[model samples]
Target: MTKRSPFLELDGVTVDFPIYSGGSRSLKKTLVSIGTGGRIKRGGGRISIQALKDVSIRLGHGDRLGLVGHNGAGKTTLLRTMSGVYEPTIGRVRASGRMATIFDFTLGLDFDATGYENITLQGMLLGLTRSGVAGLVDEIAAFTDLGGYLDMPIRTYSAGMLTRLAFAVATSTDPELLLMDEWIETGDADFFQRAEARLKTLIERAGILVLASHNLALIRHYCTSAAWLEHGQLKAIGPVEEVLAAAGLSVANAALAGRQSFSNAQ
Candidate 1:
Protein backbone atom coordinates (compact mmCIF):
# COMPACT_ATOMS: atom_id res chain seq x y z
CA MET A 1 0.00 0.00 0.00
CA THR A 2 1.24 3.48 -0.84
CA LYS A 3 1.81 5.84 2.03
CA ARG A 4 -0.78 8.63 2.17
CA SER A 5 0.26 12.26 2.48
CA PRO A 6 -1.40 14.42 5.11
CA PHE A 7 -3.69 17.07 3.71
CA LEU A 8 -6.62 19.29 4.74
CA GLU A 9 -9.04 20.87 2.33
CA LEU A 10 -12.09 23.06 2.92
CA ASP A 11 -14.45 23.42 -0.02
CA GLY A 12 -16.83 26.38 0.05
CA VAL A 13 -17.44 25.67 3.71
CA THR A 14 -20.00 27.72 5.60
CA VAL A 15 -20.92 27.16 9.22
CA ASP A 16 -24.11 28.46 10.77
CA PHE A 17 -25.04 28.21 14.40
CA PRO A 18 -28.70 28.19 15.15
CA ILE A 19 -29.82 30.75 17.71
CA TYR A 20 -32.56 29.68 20.10
CA SER A 21 -34.17 32.74 21.54
CA GLY A 22 -36.89 31.52 23.86
CA GLY A 23 -39.15 34.48 24.32
CA SER A 24 -42.30 35.99 22.97
CA ARG A 25 -42.47 35.99 19.19
CA SER A 26 -42.06 39.78 19.35
CA LEU A 27 -38.62 39.41 21.02
CA LYS A 28 -37.48 36.99 18.30
CA LYS A 29 -38.68 39.38 15.64
CA THR A 30 -36.80 42.24 17.33
CA LEU A 31 -33.55 40.26 17.28
CA VAL A 32 -33.97 39.47 13.65
CA SER A 33 -34.62 43.14 12.89
CA ILE A 34 -31.63 44.45 14.88
CA GLY A 35 -29.21 41.87 13.43
CA THR A 36 -25.84 40.90 14.98
CA GLY A 37 -22.15 40.89 14.15
CA GLY A 38 -22.42 37.73 12.08
CA ARG A 39 -24.64 37.28 9.08
CA ILE A 40 -28.11 36.46 10.34
CA LYS A 41 -30.52 34.22 8.49
CA ARG A 42 -34.10 33.37 9.39
CA GLY A 43 -35.82 30.18 8.29
CA GLY A 44 -38.46 27.88 9.78
CA GLY A 45 -38.90 30.52 12.47
CA ARG A 46 -35.31 29.87 13.64
CA ILE A 47 -32.43 32.34 13.45
CA SER A 48 -28.89 31.29 12.62
CA ILE A 49 -25.57 33.08 12.69
CA GLN A 50 -23.23 32.36 9.84
CA ALA A 51 -19.78 32.11 11.32
CA LEU A 52 -17.98 31.05 8.16
CA LYS A 53 -19.10 31.94 4.66
CA ASP A 54 -18.01 30.31 1.44
CA VAL A 55 -14.43 29.93 2.63
CA SER A 56 -12.04 27.49 0.99
CA ILE A 57 -8.43 26.53 1.76
CA ARG A 58 -6.07 23.68 1.02
CA LEU A 59 -3.03 22.60 2.99
CA GLY A 60 -0.63 19.71 2.56
CA HIS A 61 2.40 18.29 4.28
CA GLY A 62 5.03 20.88 5.25
CA ASP A 63 2.44 23.63 5.18
CA ARG A 64 2.62 26.14 7.99
CA LEU A 65 -0.38 28.42 7.62
CA GLY A 66 -1.11 31.38 9.87
CA LEU A 67 -4.60 32.84 10.28
CA VAL A 68 -4.75 36.61 10.77
CA GLY A 69 -7.73 38.80 11.51
CA HIS A 70 -9.45 40.81 14.21
CA ASN A 71 -11.24 39.18 17.12
CA GLY A 72 -14.39 37.23 16.10
CA ALA A 73 -13.15 37.20 12.49
CA GLY A 74 -13.82 33.44 12.18
CA LYS A 75 -10.20 32.47 12.92
CA THR A 76 -11.20 30.20 15.77
CA THR A 77 -14.26 29.01 13.86
CA LEU A 78 -12.09 28.04 10.90
CA LEU A 79 -9.72 26.16 13.18
CA ARG A 80 -12.67 24.33 14.74
CA THR A 81 -14.03 23.54 11.30
CA MET A 82 -10.72 22.01 10.32
CA SER A 83 -10.64 20.04 13.57
CA GLY A 84 -14.14 18.60 12.89
CA VAL A 85 -15.55 20.24 16.00
CA TYR A 86 -18.04 22.13 13.91
CA GLU A 87 -19.75 20.59 10.90
CA PRO A 88 -20.19 23.00 8.05
CA THR A 89 -23.70 24.05 7.35
CA ILE A 90 -22.88 23.67 3.67
CA GLY A 91 -19.95 22.25 1.68
CA ARG A 92 -17.28 19.84 2.86
CA VAL A 93 -14.11 19.47 4.94
CA ARG A 94 -11.76 16.63 4.07
CA ALA A 95 -8.66 15.88 6.08
CA SER A 96 -6.25 12.95 6.18
CA GLY A 97 -3.88 12.55 9.11
CA ARG A 98 -3.62 12.16 12.85
CA MET A 99 -4.88 15.49 14.18
CA ALA A 100 -4.52 17.31 17.49
CA THR A 101 -6.08 20.55 18.63
CA ILE A 102 -4.80 22.86 21.37
CA PHE A 103 -7.75 25.18 21.41
CA ASP A 104 -8.52 24.89 25.12
CA PHE A 105 -5.92 23.37 27.37
CA THR A 106 -8.41 22.86 30.17
CA LEU A 107 -11.02 21.38 27.88
CA GLY A 108 -11.29 17.96 29.50
CA LEU A 109 -9.94 18.89 32.93
CA ASP A 110 -11.73 18.12 36.17
CA PHE A 111 -10.94 20.51 38.99
CA ASP A 112 -12.29 18.03 41.48
CA ALA A 113 -9.85 15.37 40.30
CA THR A 114 -6.17 15.04 41.08
CA GLY A 115 -3.63 16.14 38.50
CA TYR A 116 -2.64 12.55 37.80
CA GLU A 117 -6.25 11.52 37.38
CA ASN A 118 -6.94 14.45 35.07
CA ILE A 119 -3.92 13.46 33.03
CA THR A 120 -5.45 10.05 32.43
CA LEU A 121 -8.81 11.66 31.66
CA GLN A 122 -7.45 14.25 29.27
CA GLY A 123 -5.11 11.79 27.59
CA MET A 124 -7.98 9.39 27.01
CA LEU A 125 -10.09 12.27 25.73
CA LEU A 126 -7.29 12.94 23.26
CA GLY A 127 -7.75 9.37 21.94
CA LEU A 128 -5.22 7.52 24.09
CA THR A 129 -6.10 4.20 25.64
CA ARG A 130 -5.78 3.56 29.37
CA SER A 131 -2.44 1.84 28.89
CA GLY A 132 -1.32 4.60 26.56
CA VAL A 133 -2.04 7.28 29.14
CA ALA A 134 -0.37 5.21 31.82
CA GLY A 135 2.77 5.06 29.68
CA LEU A 136 2.82 8.85 29.39
CA VAL A 137 2.25 9.48 33.09
CA ASP A 138 5.87 9.88 34.08
CA GLU A 139 6.74 12.11 31.12
CA ILE A 140 3.69 14.33 31.62
CA ALA A 141 4.34 14.60 35.33
CA ALA A 142 7.98 15.49 34.73
CA PHE A 143 7.03 18.11 32.16
CA THR A 144 4.47 19.69 34.50
CA ASP A 145 6.71 19.51 37.59
CA LEU A 146 3.59 19.43 39.72
CA GLY A 147 5.25 16.87 41.97
CA GLY A 148 3.10 16.09 45.04
CA TYR A 149 0.44 18.39 43.65
CA LEU A 150 -0.36 15.65 41.15
CA ASP A 151 -1.82 13.70 44.06
CA MET A 152 -3.91 16.60 45.32
CA PRO A 153 -7.19 17.82 43.90
CA ILE A 154 -6.57 20.30 41.07
CA ARG A 155 -9.04 22.73 42.61
CA THR A 156 -6.40 23.36 45.25
CA TYR A 157 -3.90 24.38 42.57
CA SER A 158 -3.29 27.92 41.43
CA ALA A 159 -4.26 29.15 37.97
CA GLY A 160 -0.69 28.95 36.70
CA MET A 161 -0.32 25.48 38.12
CA LEU A 162 -3.50 24.36 36.37
CA THR A 163 -2.18 25.80 33.11
CA ARG A 164 1.08 23.91 33.58
CA LEU A 165 -0.75 20.67 34.20
CA ALA A 166 -3.18 21.06 31.33
CA PHE A 167 -0.56 22.22 28.85
CA ALA A 168 1.70 19.32 29.65
CA VAL A 169 -1.04 16.78 29.04
CA ALA A 170 -2.30 18.56 25.91
CA THR A 171 1.04 18.63 24.11
CA SER A 172 1.90 15.02 24.87
CA THR A 173 0.23 13.76 21.71
CA ASP A 174 2.29 13.53 18.52
CA PRO A 175 0.13 14.73 15.67
CA GLU A 176 0.56 14.85 11.93
CA LEU A 177 -1.86 17.77 11.68
CA LEU A 178 -1.70 20.31 14.50
CA LEU A 179 -4.23 23.08 14.98
CA MET A 180 -3.74 25.79 17.55
CA ASP A 181 -5.94 28.77 18.34
CA GLU A 182 -3.03 30.85 19.56
CA TRP A 183 0.56 30.42 20.60
CA ILE A 184 0.52 28.56 23.92
CA GLU A 185 1.93 31.00 26.45
CA THR A 186 0.90 30.35 30.03
CA GLY A 187 2.38 29.76 33.48
CA ASP A 188 5.37 31.62 34.95
CA ALA A 189 8.27 33.02 32.91
CA ASP A 190 10.50 30.00 33.45
CA PHE A 191 7.74 27.58 32.49
CA PHE A 192 6.85 29.72 29.49
CA GLN A 193 10.46 29.58 28.26
CA ARG A 194 10.42 25.80 28.46
CA ALA A 195 6.96 25.57 26.95
CA GLU A 196 8.02 27.73 24.03
CA ALA A 197 10.89 25.37 23.24
CA ARG A 198 8.58 22.35 23.51
CA LEU A 199 5.97 24.01 21.31
CA LYS A 200 8.57 24.79 18.66
CA THR A 201 9.62 21.16 18.64
CA LEU A 202 6.01 20.04 18.22
CA ILE A 203 5.46 22.46 15.35
CA GLU A 204 8.61 21.27 13.63
CA ARG A 205 7.48 17.66 13.93
CA ALA A 206 4.00 18.20 12.53
CA GLY A 207 3.39 17.60 8.82
CA ILE A 208 0.92 20.53 8.68
CA LEU A 209 0.25 23.34 11.16
CA VAL A 210 -2.58 25.85 11.26
CA LEU A 211 -2.13 28.57 13.86
CA ALA A 212 -4.42 31.50 14.48
CA SER A 213 -2.70 34.33 16.29
CA HIS A 214 -2.73 38.11 16.56
CA ASN A 215 1.06 38.25 16.81
CA LEU A 216 2.26 39.10 13.33
CA ALA A 217 5.96 38.59 14.04
CA LEU A 218 5.33 35.15 15.46
CA ILE A 219 3.34 34.25 12.35
CA ARG A 220 6.08 35.54 10.05
CA HIS A 221 8.70 33.58 11.97
CA TYR A 222 6.78 30.29 11.86
CA CYS A 223 4.49 30.33 8.85
CA THR A 224 5.34 29.97 5.16
CA SER A 225 1.90 31.15 4.15
CA ALA A 226 -0.91 33.25 5.63
CA ALA A 227 -4.67 33.60 5.32
CA TRP A 228 -6.54 36.75 6.15
CA LEU A 229 -10.15 36.41 7.29
CA GLU A 230 -12.70 39.17 7.65
CA HIS A 231 -16.35 39.00 8.66
CA GLY A 232 -16.30 35.23 8.30
CA GLN A 233 -14.75 35.25 4.84
CA LEU A 234 -11.34 34.67 3.33
CA LYS A 235 -10.11 38.10 2.40
CA ALA A 236 -6.61 37.24 1.30
CA ILE A 237 -4.08 34.43 1.31
CA GLY A 238 -0.63 33.76 -0.11
CA PRO A 239 2.98 34.00 1.07
CA VAL A 240 3.32 35.23 4.64
CA GLU A 241 4.80 38.55 3.60
CA GLU A 242 2.26 39.15 0.87
CA VAL A 243 -0.73 38.29 3.07
CA LEU A 244 0.61 40.44 5.91
CA ALA A 245 1.11 43.30 3.49
CA ALA A 246 -2.40 42.83 2.20
CA ALA A 247 -3.73 42.87 5.78
CA GLY A 248 -1.87 46.16 6.40
CA LEU A 249 0.44 44.54 8.89
CA SER A 250 4.23 44.80 8.89
CA VAL A 251 6.10 42.07 10.77
CA ALA A 252 9.08 44.35 11.48
CA ASN A 253 6.80 47.08 12.78
CA ALA A 254 4.90 44.64 14.95
CA ALA A 255 8.11 43.33 16.48
CA LEU A 256 9.40 46.84 17.13
CA ALA A 257 6.11 47.85 18.71
CA GLY A 258 6.23 44.79 20.97
CA ARG A 259 9.73 45.72 22.09
CA GLN A 260 8.67 49.30 22.75
CA SER A 261 5.74 48.12 24.84
CA PHE A 262 8.02 45.88 26.89
CA SER A 263 10.59 48.62 27.40
CA ASN A 264 7.88 51.04 28.46
CA ALA A 265 6.57 48.52 30.97
CA GLN A 266 10.10 48.33 32.38
Candidate 2:
Protein backbone atom coordinates (compact mmCIF):
# COMPACT_ATOMS: atom_id res chain seq x y z
CA MET A 1 0.00 0.00 0.00
CA THR A 2 1.23 3.46 -0.87
CA LYS A 3 1.84 5.62 2.20
CA ARG A 4 -0.62 8.47 2.66
CA SER A 5 0.79 11.97 2.83
CA PRO A 6 0.53 13.73 6.17
CA PHE A 7 -1.88 16.63 6.75
CA LEU A 8 -3.24 18.73 9.63
CA GLU A 9 -6.21 21.08 9.67
CA LEU A 10 -8.02 23.25 12.18
CA ASP A 11 -11.41 24.61 11.20
CA GLY A 12 -13.01 27.59 12.94
CA VAL A 13 -11.39 26.52 16.18
CA THR A 14 -12.15 28.32 19.41
CA VAL A 15 -10.75 27.18 22.74
CA ASP A 16 -12.20 28.44 25.99
CA PHE A 17 -10.92 27.77 29.50
CA PRO A 18 -13.52 28.03 32.23
CA ILE A 19 -12.50 29.66 35.47
CA TYR A 20 -13.98 28.36 38.68
CA SER A 21 -14.17 31.10 41.27
CA GLY A 22 -15.31 28.75 44.05
CA GLY A 23 -17.79 31.45 45.02
CA SER A 24 -15.00 33.80 45.97
CA ARG A 25 -16.43 37.28 45.58
CA SER A 26 -12.95 38.77 45.03
CA LEU A 27 -12.09 36.42 42.16
CA LYS A 28 -14.49 38.04 39.78
CA LYS A 29 -13.08 41.54 40.35
CA THR A 30 -9.46 40.37 40.10
CA LEU A 31 -9.66 38.30 36.89
CA VAL A 32 -12.15 40.20 34.82
CA SER A 33 -10.70 41.95 31.77
CA ILE A 34 -7.15 41.30 33.02
CA GLY A 35 -4.15 39.59 31.40
CA THR A 36 -3.14 39.05 27.77
CA GLY A 37 -3.87 36.56 24.95
CA GLY A 38 -7.56 35.86 25.56
CA ARG A 39 -10.70 37.78 26.33
CA ILE A 40 -12.56 37.14 29.55
CA LYS A 41 -16.25 36.43 29.17
CA ARG A 42 -18.73 36.63 32.03
CA GLY A 43 -22.21 35.37 31.39
CA GLY A 44 -24.88 33.40 33.21
CA GLY A 45 -22.82 33.78 36.39
CA ARG A 46 -19.94 31.88 34.72
CA ILE A 47 -16.48 33.11 33.76
CA SER A 48 -14.34 31.78 30.91
CA ILE A 49 -11.31 32.81 28.92
CA GLN A 50 -11.21 32.42 25.19
CA ALA A 51 -7.70 31.32 24.42
CA LEU A 52 -8.13 30.95 20.68
CA LYS A 53 -10.83 32.68 18.72
CA ASP A 54 -12.02 31.47 15.36
CA VAL A 55 -8.59 30.19 14.28
CA SER A 56 -8.30 28.13 11.11
CA ILE A 57 -5.22 26.67 9.47
CA ARG A 58 -4.46 23.82 7.09
CA LEU A 59 -1.09 22.24 6.34
CA GLY A 60 -0.12 19.45 3.97
CA HIS A 61 2.98 17.38 3.32
CA GLY A 62 6.22 19.39 2.95
CA ASP A 63 4.70 22.46 4.60
CA ARG A 64 6.95 23.94 7.26
CA LEU A 65 5.09 26.53 9.36
CA GLY A 66 6.52 28.91 11.96
CA LEU A 67 4.39 30.52 14.66
CA VAL A 68 5.49 33.92 15.93
CA GLY A 69 3.97 36.00 18.71
CA HIS A 70 4.76 37.50 22.07
CA ASN A 71 4.17 35.82 25.41
CA GLY A 72 0.59 34.67 26.15
CA ALA A 73 -0.25 35.14 22.49
CA GLY A 74 -1.50 31.54 22.26
CA LYS A 75 1.41 30.20 20.18
CA THR A 76 2.10 27.33 22.56
CA THR A 77 -1.62 26.75 23.02
CA LEU A 78 -2.03 26.44 19.27
CA LEU A 79 0.82 23.95 19.04
CA ARG A 80 -0.70 21.89 21.85
CA THR A 81 -4.09 21.98 20.15
CA MET A 82 -2.50 20.80 16.91
CA SER A 83 -0.86 17.94 18.79
CA GLY A 84 -4.29 16.89 20.14
CA VAL A 85 -3.47 17.83 23.71
CA TYR A 86 -6.33 20.37 23.74
CA GLU A 87 -9.58 19.83 21.91
CA PRO A 88 -11.26 22.96 20.56
CA THR A 89 -14.35 24.01 22.46
CA ILE A 90 -16.13 25.24 19.35
CA GLY A 91 -14.36 23.78 16.30
CA ARG A 92 -12.62 20.72 14.92
CA VAL A 93 -9.08 19.42 14.38
CA ARG A 94 -8.41 16.82 11.66
CA ALA A 95 -5.07 15.16 11.21
CA SER A 96 -3.56 12.18 9.38
CA GLY A 97 -0.33 10.21 9.96
CA ARG A 98 1.87 9.58 13.00
CA MET A 99 2.44 12.75 15.01
CA ALA A 100 5.29 13.63 17.34
CA THR A 101 5.39 16.57 19.73
CA ILE A 102 8.48 18.17 21.29
CA PHE A 103 6.66 20.53 23.63
CA ASP A 104 8.21 18.89 26.70
CA PHE A 105 11.29 16.72 26.46
CA THR A 106 10.77 15.18 29.90
CA LEU A 107 7.02 14.77 29.60
CA GLY A 108 6.82 11.05 30.41
CA LEU A 109 10.08 10.61 32.33
CA ASP A 110 10.16 8.96 35.74
CA PHE A 111 13.00 10.07 37.98
CA ASP A 112 13.00 6.93 40.11
CA ALA A 113 13.34 4.64 37.13
CA THR A 114 16.70 3.54 35.75
CA GLY A 115 17.75 5.16 32.49
CA TYR A 116 17.20 1.96 30.50
CA GLU A 117 13.81 1.41 32.10
CA ASN A 118 12.76 4.98 31.51
CA ILE A 119 13.69 4.51 27.88
CA THR A 120 11.16 1.71 27.59
CA LEU A 121 8.57 3.76 29.45
CA GLN A 122 8.99 6.95 27.44
CA GLY A 123 9.10 5.02 24.15
CA MET A 124 5.83 3.33 24.90
CA LEU A 125 4.31 6.70 25.77
CA LEU A 126 5.50 7.95 22.40
CA GLY A 127 3.33 5.27 20.73
CA LEU A 128 6.01 2.66 20.07
CA THR A 129 5.38 -1.01 20.82
CA ARG A 130 7.53 -2.77 23.43
CA SER A 131 9.42 -4.77 20.81
CA GLY A 132 9.90 -1.69 18.66
CA VAL A 133 11.33 0.22 21.64
CA ALA A 134 13.66 -2.69 22.34
CA GLY A 135 15.05 -2.36 18.81
CA LEU A 136 15.98 1.32 19.37
CA VAL A 137 17.35 0.85 22.89
CA ASP A 138 21.00 0.47 21.96
CA GLU A 139 20.94 3.39 19.54
CA ILE A 140 19.27 5.72 22.04
CA ALA A 141 21.63 4.58 24.78
CA ALA A 142 24.72 5.22 22.68
CA PHE A 143 23.49 8.65 21.68
CA THR A 144 23.16 9.64 25.34
CA ASP A 145 26.72 8.43 26.10
CA LEU A 146 25.49 7.46 29.56
CA GLY A 147 27.35 4.13 29.37
CA GLY A 148 27.10 2.27 32.71
CA TYR A 149 25.00 5.11 34.13
CA LEU A 150 22.07 3.68 32.20
CA ASP A 151 21.83 1.11 34.95
CA MET A 152 21.44 3.84 37.59
CA PRO A 153 18.14 5.52 38.53
CA ILE A 154 17.47 8.77 36.71
CA ARG A 155 16.91 10.65 40.00
CA THR A 156 20.68 10.51 40.52
CA TYR A 157 21.39 12.01 37.11
CA SER A 158 22.33 15.65 36.68
CA ALA A 159 20.11 18.08 34.79
CA GLY A 160 22.26 17.83 31.68
CA MET A 161 22.22 14.07 31.82
CA LEU A 162 18.44 14.06 32.14
CA THR A 163 18.15 16.40 29.17
CA ARG A 164 20.39 14.16 27.07
CA LEU A 165 18.37 11.07 27.97
CA ALA A 166 14.99 12.67 27.30
CA PHE A 167 16.10 14.25 24.02
CA ALA A 168 17.58 11.00 22.78
CA VAL A 169 14.42 9.02 23.41
CA ALA A 170 12.11 11.73 22.08
CA THR A 171 13.85 11.79 18.70
CA SER A 172 14.14 8.03 18.34
CA THR A 173 11.10 7.60 16.10
CA ASP A 174 10.55 9.07 12.66
CA PRO A 175 7.37 11.16 12.59
CA GLU A 176 5.30 12.33 9.68
CA LEU A 177 3.91 15.39 11.52
CA LEU A 178 6.13 17.12 14.06
CA LEU A 179 5.22 19.94 16.45
CA MET A 180 7.78 21.86 18.47
CA ASP A 181 7.42 24.81 20.82
CA GLU A 182 10.93 26.11 20.45
CA TRP A 183 14.48 25.17 19.57
CA ILE A 184 15.95 22.99 22.28
CA GLU A 185 19.31 23.83 23.79
CA THR A 186 21.61 21.46 25.62
CA GLY A 187 24.18 22.45 28.24
CA ASP A 188 27.57 21.36 26.96
CA ALA A 189 28.96 22.62 23.68
CA ASP A 190 29.81 19.15 22.39
CA PHE A 191 26.36 17.75 23.16
CA PHE A 192 24.70 20.84 21.74
CA GLN A 193 26.47 20.36 18.43
CA ARG A 194 25.49 16.70 18.24
CA ALA A 195 21.91 17.46 19.24
CA GLU A 196 21.61 20.18 16.60
CA ALA A 197 22.77 17.80 13.90
CA ARG A 198 20.35 15.12 15.02
CA LEU A 199 17.52 17.64 15.24
CA LYS A 200 18.19 18.83 11.70
CA THR A 201 17.96 15.27 10.47
CA LEU A 202 14.69 14.75 12.31
CA ILE A 203 13.16 17.92 10.93
CA GLU A 204 14.24 17.04 7.40
CA ARG A 205 12.62 13.63 7.64
CA ALA A 206 9.24 14.95 8.81
CA GLY A 207 6.50 15.36 6.20
CA ILE A 208 5.11 18.47 7.95
CA LEU A 209 6.58 20.70 10.65
CA VAL A 210 4.90 23.31 12.85
CA LEU A 211 7.30 25.19 15.11
CA ALA A 212 6.39 27.97 17.56
CA SER A 213 9.31 30.19 18.44
CA HIS A 214 10.22 33.82 19.09
CA ASN A 215 13.48 33.49 17.19
CA LEU A 216 12.89 34.89 13.73
CA ALA A 217 16.22 33.69 12.34
CA LEU A 218 15.55 30.14 13.48
CA ILE A 219 12.10 30.26 11.93
CA ARG A 220 13.40 31.76 8.70
CA HIS A 221 15.94 29.00 8.40
CA TYR A 222 13.51 26.14 9.01
CA CYS A 223 10.05 27.30 7.88
CA THR A 224 8.83 28.11 4.39
CA SER A 225 5.86 30.09 5.73
CA ALA A 226 4.92 31.92 8.90
CA ALA A 227 1.86 32.88 10.91
CA TRP A 228 1.73 35.91 13.16
CA LEU A 229 -0.59 35.56 16.14
CA GLU A 230 -1.68 38.36 18.46
CA HIS A 231 -3.98 37.98 21.45
CA GLY A 232 -4.97 34.47 20.30
CA GLN A 233 -5.94 35.72 16.87
CA LEU A 234 -3.97 35.09 13.69
CA LYS A 235 -2.98 38.49 12.36
CA ALA A 236 -1.19 37.38 9.23
CA ILE A 237 -0.14 34.22 7.41
CA GLY A 238 2.02 34.01 4.33
CA PRO A 239 5.62 33.65 3.14
CA VAL A 240 8.14 33.82 5.98
CA GLU A 241 9.76 37.05 4.84
CA GLU A 242 6.48 38.76 4.19
CA VAL A 243 5.00 37.81 7.53
CA LEU A 244 8.17 38.83 9.36
CA ALA A 245 8.17 42.16 7.56
CA ALA A 246 4.52 42.63 8.31
CA ALA A 247 5.31 42.12 12.00
CA GLY A 248 7.99 44.83 11.76
CA LEU A 249 10.74 42.27 12.26
CA SER A 250 13.78 42.11 10.05
CA VAL A 251 16.77 39.79 10.22
CA ALA A 252 18.86 42.72 11.39
CA ASN A 253 16.59 43.69 14.29
CA ALA A 254 14.60 40.52 14.92
CA ALA A 255 16.56 39.45 17.96
CA LEU A 256 16.24 42.81 19.69
CA ALA A 257 12.59 43.17 18.74
CA GLY A 258 11.81 39.71 20.01
CA ARG A 259 13.42 40.53 23.33
CA GLN A 260 11.44 43.76 23.59
CA SER A 261 8.17 42.02 22.79
CA PHE A 262 8.83 39.33 25.36
CA SER A 263 9.67 41.87 28.05
CA ASN A 264 6.70 44.07 27.26
CA ALA A 265 4.35 41.14 27.35
CA GLN A 266 5.62 40.13 30.74
All candidates' lDDT scores? 0.88, 0.88
lDDT for each residue of candidate 2 in 1-266, tens digit (9 for 90 to 100): 78899999999899887787754346554475354424444474567788888899999999999998877889988998998889999899999998999988898788888999999999999999999999999999999999999999999999999999999999999999999988786789999999999999999999999998887878999999999988889889999999988877777778685675455423
Badly placed stretches (over 4 Å) of model 1 are 23-44, 251-266
Candidate whose TM-score is highest: 2
For model 2, give the 10-residue run with minimal summed lDDT.
Answer: 33-42
Taking the tens digit of each residue's C-alpha lDDT, what string does model 1 give over 110-157? 989999999999999999999999999999999988899999999999
| Steric clash pairs (candidate 1) | none
Alpha-carbon RMSD of each model:
5.6, 6.0
Runs in model 2 deviating more than 4 A are 24-44, 257-266
Task: State candidate 1's TM-score.
Answer: 0.86
